[model samples]
Target: MTVTASDAHSAVQTLTQSSDTLFLLLGAIMVFLMHAGFAFLEVGTVRNKNQVNALVKILADFGVSAVAYFFIGYWVAYDVTFFADANTLSQGNGYELVKFFFLVTFAAAIPAIVSGGIAERARFYPIMLATFLTVALIYPLFEGMIWNGNFGLQAWFEAKYGAGFHDFAGSVVVHGVGGWIALIAVLFLGMRNGRVKAGKHTNFAPSNIPFLALGAWILSVGWFGFNVMSAQAVNGISGLVAMNSLMAMVGGILAALVAGKNDPGFIHNGPLAGLVAVCAGSDLMHPLGALFTGLVAGAMFVFVFTYLQNKTQIDDVLGVWPLHGLCGAWGGIAAGIFGSEALWGLGGVSLTVQVMGTLLGIVVAVAGAFIVYGALRLTIGLRLSEEEEYRGADLTVHRISSTSND
Candidate 1:
């Protein structure tokens, strides 16, 4: 028995492919768990009467998102289809399958983010329809433009600014777009009933602080894979990405503590804001730059959340606009600034392109959100009946409660 050099080389190639597949599989699992974070976060934030609805909505949205992505969204974004036989699909040790699983979690987050904004008063089926359309058409169009180079947008950015718009992960592409869309949905849905009366706003206290904190913790822990494993190739992983993520997380926590005046809700969500702001630049910015970006995002969340709730009268339940929309936009632009040679970064970004791309994302998100939610509002209606609102969504929609009183 003898083994040739060519055989040895083939074996090594197979080994590397298997390792890459395994690494991505782990990343996908971690990201899938973030939906649990989304569910629990909404559950703890809404009133007790609506907790069950929150849990049910997140799970249902994920299922719908998976279907949407599998049938149409994936093809729209990547020009790839899964219509081949098992042997063809199983090539690369089924890495594409896991990759789809990974990316679908991101697409599903569109609805999850919107869920937090409009929780407690939305109809179940209407929201489901919105999630399907978003994942199927709206989100994927932009995703294709940015990630897959579908529309020559990246080429235009590169030609104009000497670098393409750089969202190493999906800061502007995923989180920013979701956040902006959620804001529109919240606005179109209007404020929660009795939230304000005669120029006085009432406090809607969280149903369970512990669950909110747990949600934040889960998201924070899983974000390492979210950011670091974005490399998608084992050899491309970097320790710097991990270090920057850590620095940003702590930075967000401290800044939110000071800005929110030690409010537990803000404290828990602070790390998330930081993580959101750091995702775009984690591969390029210095850790200190990432820390600064996180600090700004934390303070921004605290201040903007207060202003929107009190002054503008937008009842964004989890402050999704400030947390994901504003911070994610900031992350996109920050990558350009902090990723420049002048800022001690790796220097492969263009500030002009970043600003342009971020603004484009926001515009697309706002338009899509209004079109979808507005159409729903005018046609079938977006919110529940006044009686349902007072009775609570869990009982009205799900006919159940988080606690089994019966």
Candidate 2:
């Protein structure tokens, strides 16, 4: 029996809508749990005095992402056209679900970045404002360019070349963006109380390694969701992605153990480093390649942290730089290295092009964060007063009770 053209069109449309809804829902859930990961990680870094504030801020980040991404960031970061095609868009997509997961993770990342910069001393309101700008406005633009398949900068790059800036997952898009913003905030905020001396520094303390360790573990778990689900194909390639993600994590752990010749910052950031390292190439790389990438990531984290810590007096409460920035660059470069003709052919895309594309993303992400944050610093005054520093952001900004139970 021959079907009518109108009936066929209707059936196809119905199927397309159904599948898109499923994928959107899946993406949303994966992105949502990332908030739990951020909360644990931030709370762990702080002294007990600030745990309540950290938890509250973390929860607020989720709310911020949910509303901002839905109302604004989603459209800014994602919805656009590729070329001169009027009425063009991504395949069978809807805004609500795309951002449900992607922007949630994006939003959480900003607060995660801020956690290190203002950890022991920041006022909640300023940090919250920065989070909004980073996710709601600044982040959306970069994200829009990267993922907005229609008329984004990334879409233009893909059109010029063969494939888009193949971030398989977001390295520069999420991690690097947050890392730069955090770096800017730290520059304006300066070090915490007594972290520096006359050009030198006094004693530095985590004050709670257990909390840090717990956050690291949660991050490791949540990161699996982050990586595996990024296999947008769900069934076919997800297993390979999961294998690669674990391999990089293992490689990072091994490298960290070795790096802990005497100091154990490697242990703290081991899994975190691996997750960031493989982000660029997770879908493309084999397990062995991911392991090697992870090893490089672990070493990179150690090297960047040691050099930065000694060189600059910046007080990153969570050391987000080594985890996100150094390793994010590694993720992009790894895409160039591990991207293979044997596995997933670039269909003739040059390694140089891939690497350039990745670097281009870095340029955009860093520049965007720097400009917005610099302006925000000048206009609103990024950091709190000296009196507020010792008091903690919880007490100074929100003026809430500080009981451990609360």
- Give the TM-score of each candidate: 0.99, 0.84
Flag regions of model 1 displaced more than 4 Å. none
- Which 10-residue window in model 1 sums to the lowest lDDT? 397-406
Lowest summed lDDT across 10 adjacent residues in model 2 is found at 80-89
TM-score of 2: 0.84
Per-residue lDDT for 64-134 in model 2, tens only? 65666666766676563233343343345553346356546656676666666567666566666667766
Residue 35 error, candidate 1, Å: 0.6
**TM-score of decoy 1:** 0.99
Error of 2 at 399 (Å): 3.8
Q: What is the lDDT of residue 138 in candidate 1?
A: 90
The residue pairs that clash in candidate 1, if any, are none
Look at candidate 2 and give me any clashing residue pairs. Answer: 44-211, 77-144, 81-150, 81-151, 82-150, 82-151, 116-317
